[model samples]
Target: MKFFKTSLLLFSTLLILFSCRTEEIQIIDPPIENELAANSTVAKLMKNTVAKDGSKDNIIDKASCLSVKLPVTVTVNSKEITVNDEDGYEEIEDIFDLFDNDVDAIVISYPIEVILSDYTVKTVNSDEELQRLAENCTGENEADDDIECLDFYYPLKASVFNANLELILTITIEDDEQMHKLIEDLEDYSAVTIEFPFKVILNGDTYVYINNMQELEEALEAAKNSCDEDDDNDYNDDDCDKCSTEGIKKIFANCNEWSVEKLYLNEEYLTEEFKMFTFSFRENGSIKIDNNGDISEGIWEITGEGNEMSFSINIPDYPAFNGTWYLHEVKEDSGEVSVHLLLEGNHLRFKSQCSTVKDGLNAILLAEGSIWAVESYKNTGEDETAVFADYQIYFYSENVVKAKKDGAVIEGVWESLNDGSMLALNFSDEPVNAFNKEWEVAVMSETEVVLEANDKRLVIKRIN
Candidate 1:
């Protein structure tokens, strides 16, 4: 009695499982909406590529694969096989068949029809309606005669396979033109996954399939109407906290505080540019100062919280002026500075002069044939590298020099006086020192511009 009861229970369990699985695959009547329109090199020769019925048994063995059609709608090896878009396309690859002792040939053709089985999210322009479709996808069912569809969008990843059962192609799609072409040229019996709505190409042909057409059209329409909603403004994504509107506002505020204008300064204006400098603080703890072509320096400082910064420099042959400086003014793109110079023997108080900046290329005061000050060497205290002084000489754009005085900014088209790799400095107008010397560009970088003349190299630290 016990054995009979156990057998009966097992039979009942199997029947229940079978019924549940069958119920899951409901055969619905076929709908008529699923329809769509459609659309290299290498060597060697192989024989015996065709079977008895004149079909390509192995394309690799064919010396020349002929463009043949499905004669009488026959199947191959008892499997539903169809010629891919690559079927008629010839000369695809040339492989060496070692066993056959011949170079295997490859042929290509078009008109591939694939029975796709996977439903993937496709990336298209952001459309809420299509997004809803993607979220509601019921997936694919093989046993069901009827198919269900939705309006969804997501990123798509796709690949292609060859007769050898190896993945031979992979592509990505994000653009409409590319996606449209991809759906038009699929190989028969292939599959596609619409992961993200990007553009993709396969086997040198665009694919067009029935599965992607409706969603694609809907997604495109949604994208067209959803243009006003920018991703940058919607900082609600999990990773978008870093780009919050409040964070951006704070950055702009700092930029507003340290703004500086481009100006020219010289004997006409005894005061330095702006007379004060400013800096902007960023949420990421970084700072930015701006400059135009004339200024050539964009200095910034990144520091720990609540700590002062010590700006350093190496002035040739002279003792450095080390000090604590505070923010004087801030602007969107530039700033001014108030530096307290602390020297070993003297305390120097200086205010930078401000002037509207002119174009550097246009700021040229040419001395092509005119006499000017050339740099002469100077030795200060015990410094090994001797500083130079201003001397009188003539030059073209091909020569370089040095400036000695502290109260001067060279404004002329400077050049390498000697044959060497150096920056060319140009002046705004004909200054006394400019006529007196040929200034050599000492340092050149994105943020720092320095010129060495006389025994001194004037360093312009970009505070703006």
Candidate 2:
């Protein structure tokens, strides 16, 4: 009886040990590349659509070398849609909003018309001949009477991909009153043209036409101006437009259109000299945050119109943080613009907002207190210039100061006191950059200040 009882106890212990010793299941994380495969595929697919149907395909393959003469006004179905404002007044406002929000591209549709002016289609070897032809074709008397220049005509009706992936043809159609008859003629002409060893793709449908390359380029230029960004012109606000026309009529003669101007924070502030926290939008309609400032190229998304602009930015660094920005509230006829930004679940601040005038000029110079930064004087004293990685602080406005050193950030209110003609900075705490460490705003004249906690002696000159 004792032996049997011992055996039963031993058997139970072995069973328990076997159950406890089950193989450990490892939960390995997915590969980074694999995790983003779905999104990457979608982007590639979008590229394919544009490349396949658009001029990019031809550019890549080197098969059909067609250089589109820009600024060529096109008309579709007797509608005038686009114009060229050589001064960039038409596109500046949208451009600024685009940069501020971090948008790359969008699909917009519009009715268009193209006037088939005299042009020469040629190869790279015939560039000079083409130029000569263009020069010869200039002036009304030089235009060929045999070929109707006034009649918009399509040489090729549709584009088809060749075996080498080159665009075989760019579709064109006649801008004429008899488009119905023209379609019927095209159907029969192909039957005869095939015998002559020519194959043409037919443009059977029409919805939207790509804006003339020249016009699109011009628009981008206007946008670049609107953002008030000058890459090579850093530290010189000499030509910078501080304000943007949110929605104002820019008139040139009888032709008038509405445009907006925006301040480009990207260009105004030094990206390399200072660390910037970037926020962007996500595919899931949520804002993504990135602190590293890499992973995706930044894009600004601009929505709404006129004085009211809903701005959003997407940064490759901060994938999770995204939010909407707006102009500050103003009474009608006040002609005041207040820029405001809202990050998800975060308190709103002044740095996020920028104010502008009806003419798209920043209102700061005209404001009671304008927060501006000028060129810095070269430090002669034995001191280290502010180190960005180890320690930094961002003083955006009189009320907000964010200080950071060694990967930690502290935020609080701040103030600047006036001593005679100079301005002195006083923070809520000793800034991470150090208080006694001196800095100067290099204006036209010399101004110096010895900074201390809650007190400073400053000499400054204002240049408008």
Candidate 3:
């Protein structure tokens, strides 16, 4: 019958070419390493309970760029909770309106904080934001006023391979909207993908598509050198010489009862029986302050070593139970058994006071179109956080204090001590790296503000 009807049309075109070569484009080699993520999407952003703060609801939005650290704690129903501003501040403001519609999921926690940059190609001289960024770029310019963009800065972190995730950052590139969606590119796809949620794997034929702009700047310099590294380690796979600083001084040198969760003085906050006092720390520095079980008599030291050390104590006559400290960075995947403190310039804060723990601090809504950003300053804490990241400090309700960068806005005169205990910031000609002087307001919020001089401690954060 015509060769059995052409052998049934050649076995149906060889079964549709073997189902199109078994559906090609594979790509998902996820897990990004360091600790196998636990294996992908950073193990759905970390857990074992209480999403460590990337969101178990401290709040997540601003387009899921993410924001956290407010005494965090989760597990809403099976018990175990905490979200402070005084115990579940109205359920953390109704869980920031219940995750404000989860802005397209980008949950980030762990030590994985981010802000790396190499981006700097500015260009676009504004004509209504270059007609909305030239409808997605068609570069090599000729018209579209030489389009360029990709400025930088503003929350975008999570790609921690080789494990160290405990990195704090501040890599502003400028004019952002997450650098206008990583320098868009019309149909010009060349792989940029950092719409962060975590996933990386470059060498063994690393995928996620890339071709030109020099393989999209070598896949953004191999995902910013696998998400930043200069020994600020934490993308995990163990053995960073066992998380160095001589393994965090042999894991905090030993014998530390600590127990004083938090107890600030002028920066106020001495919670529940004033954080049930109990301070012990001896590997020979000799110190003990147990107030409730009475133990007092301190004298400790350890000045500058890895990560620029500083943790002094004296308690003889007590100057707010002796000062000098720095080591508040919690989470190395935080599995408690803690010892956190921060005095130098932040006045005070000590944690490790269990019994159903607690933590919360995020203030500095000092007012008047507030805008601060001098994160860290203990002498030259990174050149006063790079001269206040090019200045921008303003606070007034007639307490006056102003300093903007990029255009004359100088004006400073702030005072606070009448039992508000020291906070003086003056400025006549200003430019004295330390932002004029006087401080002691440890923690403030509306999003962050810590300060302390003479032992230097200055952390200010609130960029608009």
- Best lDDT goes to which candidate? 3
Give the C-alpha lDDT of model 3. Answer: 0.40
Compared with the true structure, what per-residue lDDT tens digits does model 2 show for residues 247-278? Answer: 31121111111112223243342233223443
Q: Give the per-residue lDDT digits (tens) of candidate 1, residues 252-320.
A: 432234432322122123224433444343454344333332222223332222223222322222122
lDDT score at residue 69, model 3, on the 0-100 scale: 38
lDDT of 3 by residue, 1-464 (tens): 01112245643543342222222233332232222122233222111111111112223211111233345444432334555543363333322223224432222223222211222233333334333433343222112211121111224332111112222111222233333322321112212123332222332112232222244344444343232111211211222222334434433443245665555555455545546677766666777777777666878776555445666777884566567775433323222444444553243434442211111111133654667767656574344455556877776757777877789777877765422324678865656334566675544445665666665767778777
Could you give the candidate ranking by lDDT, starting with the highest?
3, 1, 2
lDDT, candidates in the order shown: 0.29, 0.28, 0.40
The 10 consecutive residues of candidate 3 with the worst lDDT sum are 46-55
TM-score of each: 0.17, 0.17, 0.23
Q: Write down the RMSD of candidate 1 (Cα, Å).
A: 33.0
Superposition error at 427 for model 3 (Å): 25
Off by over 4 Å in 2: 1-116, 120-263, 266-283, 287-464
- Whose TM-score is greatest here? 3
Output the better candidate (2/3) by TM-score: 3
Off by over 4 Å in 3: 1-77, 80-176, 180-182, 185-219, 224-259, 262-271, 276-280, 290-464
